[model samples]
Target: MKIQFLNQEHETKFQELRLGMAEYYRNNKEYLSVVYIMAGNEELHRKMNRYFNTKEGMFSSDDMFNEEDFSSGNRILAKLAVHLFNDNETVSPLDIISALDDEWFQLALNAIHFRRYGISSGYDFPEEKLYM
Candidate 1:
């Protein structure tokens, strides 16, 4: 399931992530050589390897999505960005619906991301539909 963030910074703040990421990489070039994020939790740390073809960086889960989907507009990327750019922002929500399921992880992840951005779920769990 999709979620509607109070501020919905995924669209606007993504630029922040892109800029911060660029700055981060520029400032610390060693991360390109080694940075570890669990599984798909931080795919970019993984993708950065493939995109650059570093000696030790050989796998990129980005293949899960096509090359064209590199932008942050993708829901997954948006979530990643929200968490990545988090700088002491806490975004709340208007309503949360679950069809009465106990799948709180989705809500937690969403809330956690929002907590980062000061703003913003998942399935009961399956296809998500977000409304503005």
Candidate 2:
């Protein structure tokens, strides 16, 4: 995501947060698949960092990228996501959220909910046309 730190300190904090999440899932390793999509936004990253970098929360965006262009899409986390999603095995919501490269926590939440509810792509939530 496009993450712009107000200063170097903020940048450092962001990195710490991202790395912390990565380490958590690496140790757990209990899932069939995971996919992390990075939003690639600087402001969003900073906002997320400020909002999530809390002691009692499940989300954070510290150590976020300076810009979407700076991110290497083929990082260890990305690889893991590919492996997990392709394997078709049940995974952990927290674990999956931790692996996300993107700063968009909402997507992470959606991923967790989707998996928990057993709904794949193209599957409507209620199986009905709401507009009709």
Candidate 3:
């Protein structure tokens, strides 16, 4: 399924916001990912005891990518929607994930417990999809 916007203006505004982000890395081939520290599993969080550039509050679940992310495929997008157009609504970021493709998604999930996370999301991405 695809994102269903409120209307033409809503779609236009969302596209513009995404385009602004996309333009920021037009010539750059490198990619990075958001490392989220979820609200649960404190024991595991402490056992690992390592974090860099992690933002807390909500987590990205494997279930998130499949069909949902609790709130709008992820809360981040919902927040952005609220901030950007005052729309206060969002579809799942799975659309963004789909743009990133499935292999990268699986690779990203696999790396969650790794001590050293890779710079790029995953390999074998096509030119268009390489935007990350």
Candidate 4:
């Protein structure tokens, strides 16, 4: 995603949010496969962060997902898919990732990483179509 930040402060907040998510997944290895799509805008990130960082509430409640729940991955992936796709059709990260054979997966990963580091190159796809 393009992930345009209104200002440098928002971009810094997003970086912080990403770091926190990385740590969470690192600590909870079971959820490592849960795919999270970066937001395309700062307002979305702000809203998502509230749920992700809060101690309790609808999104942050303990009942949201348990490690034992096999469907946890689906739930998380669905949430991300909705945000990224914003289509009436439902899609899952696993579905997309599994469809990516080794070559495509590596290409996508490279593109994502390049964007993450704010790097640009001739091979880079447009931000809007990065995932596709």
Best-performing candidate as measured by TM-score: 4
Off by over 4 Å in 4: 1-14, 21-39, 54-78, 81-89, 92-132
- Model 4 TM-score, all chains together: 0.27
Please give, for residues 4-97, the per-residue lDDT of candidate 2 as tens digits.
3333444454334434554434222222113122222343343333433224323322232222222332233333333334432234555546
* lDDT ranking, high to low: 4, 2, 1, 3
Ranked by TM-score from best down, the candidates are 4, 2, 3, 1
lDDT for 3 in candidate 3 is: 26
- Model 4 lDDT tens row, 22-123: 443332211211122223333334334444432221244233333223243334433443333223235455754875455334433433443344422222
Total clashing pairs in model 1: 8
- In candidate 3, what are the lDDT values of residues 1-132, reduced to their tens digit? 122233344335433323333443322221112211121212222322232112222233322334433332234422222222223334344553654334333323322322134323233323332121
Residue 81 displacement in candidate 3 (angstroms) = 6.7
Residue 67 of model 1: what lDDT? 56
lDDT of each: 0.31, 0.34, 0.29, 0.36
Local accuracy of candidate 1 as per-residue lDDT tens digits, 4-108? 322333323332332334432422222211221111224443444344333332333344334524333223333332333332222233222322122323433
Q: Which ten residues in a row have the lowest lDDT in candidate 4?
A: 27-36
Cα-based TM-score, every candidate: 0.20, 0.24, 0.21, 0.27
In model 2, which regions exceed 4 Å deviation? 1-80, 87-103, 120-132
Better of 2 and 4 by lDDT: 4
